[model samples]
Target: MSTTTQEAFWSGEFGKAYSDRNNWTSAQYDDFYRHEWGITKTQMNEDCLRDLPKDAKILEVGCNIGLQLRCLQEMGFTNLYGIELQHYAVEKAKEIVKNVNIIQGSGFDIPFKDSYFDVVVTNGVLIHIAPDDLPRIMSEMVRCSKKYVWGFEYFASSLVNINYRGNEGFLWKADYSKIFQENFHQLQEIYRKMYPYVSASQQGNMDYMYLLEKQ
Candidate 1:
């Protein structure tokens, strides 16, 4: 599907569905990361903050409910900013992290100056975007970061078909090494194992946490 069509579909359907109480819950969010993604707040903090300089400026795309923001704060990261599309999630985030500078915006159109952040982080956000928008969004990510860009995303060799909540489409996976080489040098890649409880249909599914430094 075209980018415009995909954006419209997501803005209306997936966004609303996820923001709905019946569709999403705080417990589900915690469980998904802890059980499904195999992430802990400590691990998330270390992964994002280790290479970053003290008091570095950081931006997180599609940061839901500021869970990671709390983690960043615990790691002594002060200059943190985030962009999230869902209003409900944004509101919840504000309640948890009062000092966070969270903006309601699209990942493809981040509202920040070029090279404004020392690091840019995103987790599980890329899967929601349509395949065609990936390049543009990635460019935006590169444009905003001065030093490094870290991402944890779901991967498949090619686009994979999935159906959920009246939305059906293929999620694309790019050759990260190839793509990063075009604009940055890869520093590290940490692969996270898939959870056992995930459906067999999602077998072979893996999450990769990548760290890239601008060339």
Candidate 2:
């Protein structure tokens, strides 16, 4: 596979298929989160982000259909922005999320100036990136955030590749928070939570969420 094969796979027909499969309303998203983690996505946000001002500028990198952004918006966060690699998801997000900026953009090349956003985030996005390219994309998140970098992703004690829809080189799990702290020493981790899946099909999987502040 090419080093950047993930970009093609996630920007083309497969990406559209994934978006259609997960095109859920805010309520549907909350229900899924409640089933998986016993709390709504909004509640998770509130737990991690209660310290942020309601008007803080937040950007979600690789925000597929902006479900997470919708959750933040529901929590009274006024300045929400999202960058999605898939054009189809961008359009769908525009249709679904009111008053939020949803744009087609890549995580490797976030089209924002340094410190443009109060917080930069990703939910379930980093796992799809190639391991060698992770630092570059994550650096973009750090470069754009004025205060915080947050992520929700699959977790493993070490890096491990997983077959995604029978496709190799498409998914991975790692101790993402540790990697972030190691790679960017200036950003200190402020919060973290781990939730093991309660849903039957994914019972063995654990999801991790973390918040890092620029110090």
Candidate 3:
């Protein structure tokens, strides 16, 4: 089977091992929930989220274990869906977040009709995509969303590569928002913010959150 490097890395034994290590205990639940909650608050204020139709569909790409979708569901968004590349993660997400739909899939080809969702979003996902293949991933995301696209990823003013767990090509930081605007002529920037570097181990790491609306 022809697979991208990502699919090969995240779908085998190593992927299963990563999945096994991905669960959260009760002790860590509060922090995780709070983090996602804060993002929802920001999304609401920036994207006119409160004014969206009650049943507006939202899909989170790379939604591992459904933390973001769970937050949306808890925050009263009626239609929530997530697509994950890891089967173990998808199973866990479905078991835990029973109210939301979780599917095992990839970003290269989102298995949904064009404009099927009101918003297509991803948290820390785009940075992993190889730049040569980024346009395909970005187009697939925007194609699935009827009105908006949201992204939260490590951001830099220019493209920068970082070693992740000793892996050379997996992680990167870049001006993702600018990439968005450049790729789509009608995309209007609604919000952009660089979060403070907070992780103890990755001291210099910073994340950016962006919400863009299509005109």
Candidate 4:
């Protein structure tokens, strides 16, 4: 994730276009935002967050324009920080969510120390990474989370490839939550939800979201 060719593809032109295309009308973002942030009215009342404080330490990797962070901020949760791979997205996030820290960095090699956040989250970012690089990214996500990690990504029953805007091997769908549960001894699933593609909000993914607690 040290600015590899794949990383460059994300941090470059295609990534910028992806960021720009997320400008949706509020109604279009009703159930699911473009990148699978928890924006739907129902998602606001998630059970796993019952004990999380308003000032809980939260970090979002690949947080494009900080919309997810903004949602949390509006819900009165401060102490938000986001690290994005694209320089354009970082700048956009900083500009949009002025109070949050928006840094440009890779998820594979996070800049933070171990267990630095109350919850570390990734939104639709993992599948873009090559399978060979995914282990390190997953390790970093767990390494930085003090208690919980959340993911919302494209899903398939097995590892399956999908062309991303004519770029092959750039997108994949898999049971990422299953990978976490099996690979990390301490991690346990607290919640999992899947949105069928036929739903009103067919936001690019047969999306799945999971919450893993490091208990």
TM-score of 2: 0.96
As a whole number from 0 to 100, the lDDT of residue 20 in candidate 1 is 56
By TM-score rank, best first, the candidates go 2, 4, 3, 1
lDDT of 3 at 109: 82
Shift of residue 169 alpha carbon in model 2, Å: 0.6
Model 1 ranges off by over 4 Å: 1-3, 20-32, 37-41, 170-203
Clashing pairs in 2: none
lDDT of 4 by residue, 39-153 (tens): 5723542544657798889999889887777767766788998998888888878777768988988887889999999999988888887777777788999999999998878
lDDT of 2 at 168: 96
lDDT of 2 at 7: 90
Write the number of the candidate with greater TM-score, choosing between 2 and 4: 2
User: What is the per-residue lDDT of model 2 for residues 137-174, given as tens digits with 9 covering 90 to 100?
Assistant: 88999999999999999999999999999899999999
Show where candidate 3 strays beyond 4 Å: 25-54
TM-score of each: 0.76, 0.96, 0.86, 0.87
Ranking by lDDT: 2, 4, 3, 1
Off by over 4 Å in 4: 24-28, 31-48, 199-205
Superposed by TM-score, candidate 4 places the C-alpha of residue 65 at a distance from the truth, in angstroms, of 1.3
Q: Give the residue spans of candidate 2 off by over 4 A.
A: 1-3
lDDT of 2 at 179: 85
